[model samples]
Target: MLETGQVISAENGQAQVHFKRTSACERCGACGMLANGQDMIVTLENTIEARPGDQVVVQMQTQGMLQASAIAYVIPLLLLIAGAVLGKLALAPLFAGVESDVVAAISGIALCALGFLGIHLLEPRLRRQKRFQLQMVSVHRAAQGREEEQIDKE
Candidate 1:
């Protein structure tokens, strides 16, 4: 995804860019509530040497976004189904007195919880990978005019 933001701070080779949540952000659900409001800030590697108050374009890989969306949404659903099936077919048999449906519900919830834990554990490693990183595409020095336009519209 591509976005425009203002560099709120800069240090070393990185900058924290503040972006107003766009229509695309509402649909993506990537940042959750952080993207629900107007103030969304992200720290990114400032390869273009953008200073504080600079308007910048940010670029993120579509492929990585899709992969992350799948990891966040799909895997847990599959695991929940798998757990429920296993509980109904395998576990219910072992517990002779228990109802199969009840066992399935319990197991499904347990596995879904485990899936969330797995994602939590995997997040740090995913963040460290370059393919998942957000990059600053360009710095715009003529941001004052655009900023004024934005304020007038608001």
Candidate 2:
């Protein structure tokens, strides 16, 4: 499932978010990581609404990650395979008297083009759907560590 959420705070290469999860998320790989209330750093790929201390709803799609990944990978491979089969069949008659290598070249080119098109369309959408839980919040109103500069010093 896809979720649109907000960043509550940022710290140490991570951001804490109060995200709403859908039923599909129960099967997510990341959900397993967050199962024990242990903090996990998730790579935030996209956000519809974001701000410090803002309420945001994450869009969660109900497909399990493995199934979703299979769909993403298998579809393109099928496209390439189909392209190769169709290419070979179409070129067979035209090159009936030509060398076998020449026919292979033609089919290879066709399959490559098919694969490229598949990758072009699928890769971006898959990446944009990524969302993860924040392991830690870095930003704070008051400094708790020595890194906190004294307001009076400056």
Candidate 3:
């Protein structure tokens, strides 16, 4: 849904936005993130003429940042824990009663390694998807009609 929001932070062609939800977003993966509240990243085609604390109207699709970040960590952790548990309960009996703790530890370590590898593989693509700064559209003031606003940000 489209709504007006403020720029909370901006740097290096990116801005962190804060806005309220206008419509109930089901977050049906159309936005590629979960829609829970009114916080989002707006990437601009050019350097935005907005500074922090400026109110701008943002039209964005809602998505799940929390879910993505959580899935990145939690699934691997669960796999690790389960592997450790299973190693102790099921496999320990086969290897002349190998120590469950040791087996679990090894499995957990392997799972953690795999998880980290996945993160490393995805890091570059994720970075590329980060928002770029948006340019200023026309600015309107009560005293003035619609005028183009431009800023010289070095």
Candidate 4:
């Protein structure tokens, strides 16, 4: 996804850009850090030396987003199915056809919960990887009063 935002602050070769919420972002809860439904601040390297009040274009890799979606949604589903099958197999002999299915269902739910917990704990590290981050690739306007778009070679 691509977005246009103004740099709110700049320091240490990085900038925090403030972006207004758009219809394209409505379904994407990826920016969960948004304080409200209307705005978001993203910190990224200021490759174009953009300053506060500068307009910039941010690019987020669509492939990485899809991979993240799979990790967040599909893995737990697979775990649930595996847990159900394993639980049923293990309890079948013990229960001998008595409430084993119920026990398996509970085990599947518990296993899926664990999967979610694991993903939550690893999120910070996953987010630190560059492939999953948004990159500011162009400057629409510099704080120095230029109105030209500056495109950088990626």
Candidate 5:
């Protein structure tokens, strides 16, 4: 996805850009939707020589985005289903006296929680990888002017 953001700060080959959340951002939910209407600020490598106050278009890798979405959404769901099946089949047989349904519920919940914890633990390592990073495509001078004009009109 491509987004327009204003450079908030720049130094030593890096820049911090602030993006206001829009309706499109709601669909992605990359930044948590807390209902606070706050801006999403990200620090990116400054290959384009964008300065503070400059408006630029940022691009995130499409493949990486899809991979991330799968990792965040699909994997946990698959894990939950696997957990439920395991509880019903494997774990139920081991806990002889207990009700099979109850054992299944408990085991499934435990495994689902473990899946979430695993994702949390893996996040930091994912962030350090360059393949998943967002990039600044170009400074959008014309778009910036249009934005300022709209603000003035409002």
Candidate 6:
């Protein structure tokens, strides 16, 4: 996906870009959220030599986005279901006086929590992979008021 933003800082071949949360971003909070909920900051490889304060466009590989979404959404859900089923079938019998439903609920929640922890621990490694990285594509000049007026005139 392509995103447009202004470079907040750049160094060591990487840049932090400031972007307004767009429609796509609202639908996908994989990048997380900042305070006020309308702004986002992304750090990416400065492939085009983007400097701080420069307007630029960046692109993220589609495969990376899909993998992230699945890891974030699907794994936890599957774990919850699996845990519940296992707890109801095996664990509940092992716990005297515990209802199968209660055991299932607890097991499902605990397993989902573990899944989140696993994802957190795995974050640094996944982030280092190039497939998940974003690359700055090009820097663009900020439009001037006179330019807008001229374009409108035409």
- Local accuracy of candidate 3 as per-residue lDDT tens digits, 3-38: 455666768866555545345443422222326544
* Tens digit of per-residue lDDT, candidate 1, span 1-154: 8899888899989898888888777655454345447668788888887878878888879998888878888999999999999999989999888999999999998999999999999998988877787887777764555552222110
Total clashing pairs for each candidate: 0, 12, 9, 0, 0, 0
lDDT of 2 by residue, 89-125 (tens): 6766677788655675667667767776876677566
User: lDDT of all the models against the reference?
Assistant: 0.81, 0.48, 0.54, 0.82, 0.78, 0.82
How do the residues 45-78 of candidate 5 rate in per-residue lDDT, one tens digit apiece? 9888777887878888889888878878888888
Which candidate ranks first by TM-score, i.e. highest?
A: 6
Candidate 3 C-alpha error for residue 111, in Å: 0.8
Every model: Cα RMSD to truth: 5.5, 11.3, 8.4, 2.7, 5.8, 5.3
Residue 68's C-alpha lDDT in candidate 1? 81
**TM-scores, each model vs. reference:** 0.84, 0.38, 0.44, 0.79, 0.80, 0.86
| Model 2 lowest lDDT segment of ten | 132-141
How should the candidates be ordered by lDDT, best one leading? 4, 6, 1, 5, 3, 2
Model number with the top lDDT: 4
lDDT of 2: 0.48
Evaluated against the true structure, the overall lDDT of model 5 is 0.78
Full-model lDDT, candidate 4: 0.82
Ranking by TM-score: 6, 1, 5, 4, 3, 2
Residue-by-residue lDDT tens digits, candidate 6, 31-112:
6567989998887777777777678877779999899889989999999999999899989999989888999999999999
Model 1 weakest 10-residue run by lDDT: 145-154
